[model samples]
Target: MERDSTAGGAEDLLLEDTVSKLRAGSLHKHELAEAMEVEQEGLVEHQPLEQDDLNFEKWKPKPKPKRTLHEKIDDLKTYLWNAETKEFMGRSGKSWSLILLFYSALYIFLAAMFAGCMCCLMWSISPYAPTYNDRVMPPGMTMFPHVDVAHGFDVAFNASDRSSWRKYAKALEAHLKSYDDGVQDRRNINCEGNTYFMQDDLEESAERKACQFKRSWLGECSGMKDKDFGYSKGKPCILVKMNRILGYLPGQGTPVHVTCGVKKGSTEGLGEVQFFPENIFNLRYYPYYGKLRHVNYSSPLVAVHFPSVPYDTQLHIQCKLNGRGIINDSPTDRFLGSVSFTLQVGA
Candidate 1:
């Protein structure tokens, strides 16, 4: 019985210790709740202050400071030339040098290629004669005082006007300047009148000698005798010459002659016409070798003189070349065969 009573007493002590631990735990939980509530109240109070600061900052934003003109120019200058970065015009010095070098080399190569092509083309061409003469075949005839009118040759002037006729006379004077007797005697040889002066052999200077054609052969129509070329006297002289072709033999052995008359269907009458020296182109000027070979070469001239053309009349005149191997009537090319012109004399 005594042992049973001691056991009951130990059980009561254990229950009391358990109850005390439960009470201590409840007090600690109550203190933790109070500390959490105090911290939440402090956070709630700071939140409104933070929101007011944000609203205040949004209401009035700080303005950007305005730069003066001098400051802006200074900024632009710094952008154009940045000394710290060693850059000019938005590029570093080394980068700009490389770009300039690349373009310079590219342009130099292109210029060299162009110069090389031109040199090769020039080397293939003959200096003396043209490479192709197909378009210039059969040759063409031209006249001095060549006044162009509506795609055709026309000579119209007042006979009494010295200013008008003086230009024609001056043109003739310039044309015949190379054919002067003194110039011809020095540069050319006097060949037979009706025979060809064939120069098969080249001279010591690697050139062929040309025949002399003195201005004196033109007689009264020559500017040497009459400075006016008969224009002031109402008698105008027109000089005719044949175009030169390389290695071309015109008229064969026969003499080429010029015949001028009123064009067909022309109402106006052509008065008396005269040819200086003769109406013929002498045979000595044939078989032209090129400009380089035929040095000092002068094409022979035929002066046609209108001794008595009617005053105040426009006469359509056609001068034709008549000889063997010379095509004088080409349908397609009017200038290729012969030359036609309109003549108007004013009082």
Candidate 2:
């Protein structure tokens, strides 16, 4: 009985201790709740969503607009063309400039093509310019104006008898004697323009030789020499000589091709346009034209035939030492040395 009573009292004490601890824990939790409530007194969330509102202290920026290809290209173009020149000129101002640019590009492209073609064209195929190994070309240079000089002479002789040869020689002798185109006189009288007439100077003198002719061979200089300018019963060769370079006045026809044979024999049967080339200066600075930069080797012959040609070939060149210093290579030294050669009929 005493033991049962003691057990009951112990159980009561244990229950009281448990109640006290629960009370202490409840009080701590209440203090925490109160602190939280105090902190939220002035702040309020206005969200009306059913779910708990999320913290939105930071905001995301919107994405940049996408650019189109055309728009991007337009912007680039605008930036480029906004220069004062383009803007002031506008479409009209640009028209001429654009045309000039286009033509320039076209001309450059064509020049490249022409240069490429130069190596291939039979007439332009000169083994001399690139392959020659001479400081100055030898004499007797006008032998082969074109390979046709021989063939043309052949055709001429075959067209007539030895009398044609006699006539040609007599005409040649007389031509050599005259001061200037005296043989052209009788030539123009009888063989006037129907077939081929001697130019006015050719018509003016029976005693002078302005040009030469052979009946049969042109490509290979034959009959008169191993080679002739052309082979024709009615062939012609003209000569024009000067002590110095009289500045080139525009001519009427045919492109003048220059060669490098200064020696006398170099121009045997071919037309010898003798000139002691004392190169002239001040031509470049005149500002009227770019520069008098080429040798018009065949102008006299062409002028003899037709009289209204203009602008000779403008050779492209740059200054460089010709084995001598620039001082040694002055305008006087810039001789268009023995620059003469033959070409087939009309070339």
Top-scoring candidate (lDDT): 1
Worst 10 residues of 1 by lDDT: 197-206
Please give, for residues 3-98, the per-residue lDDT of candidate 1 as tens digits.
Answer: 889998889999999999999999999999999999999988887555567777678879999999999999999999999998998899899999
Candidate 1 off by > 4 Å: 1-72, 147-152, 193-195, 200-205, 264-268
TM-score of candidate 2 to 2 decimals: 0.15
Highest TM-score scorer: 1
What tens digits encode model 2's per-residue C-alpha lDDT throughout 1-347? 99999999999999999999999999999999998887776344543544433434334576789999999997777765656456533454568688889999999999999987875775644322323334332111111112244443121222144443344344433433322234334332211111211222433212322222222211222223422222242243323222122222211122122322223333233333321121121112111111132111111221011111111211121111111111222344332222233232221
**Cα lDDT listed for each candidate:** 0.85, 0.33
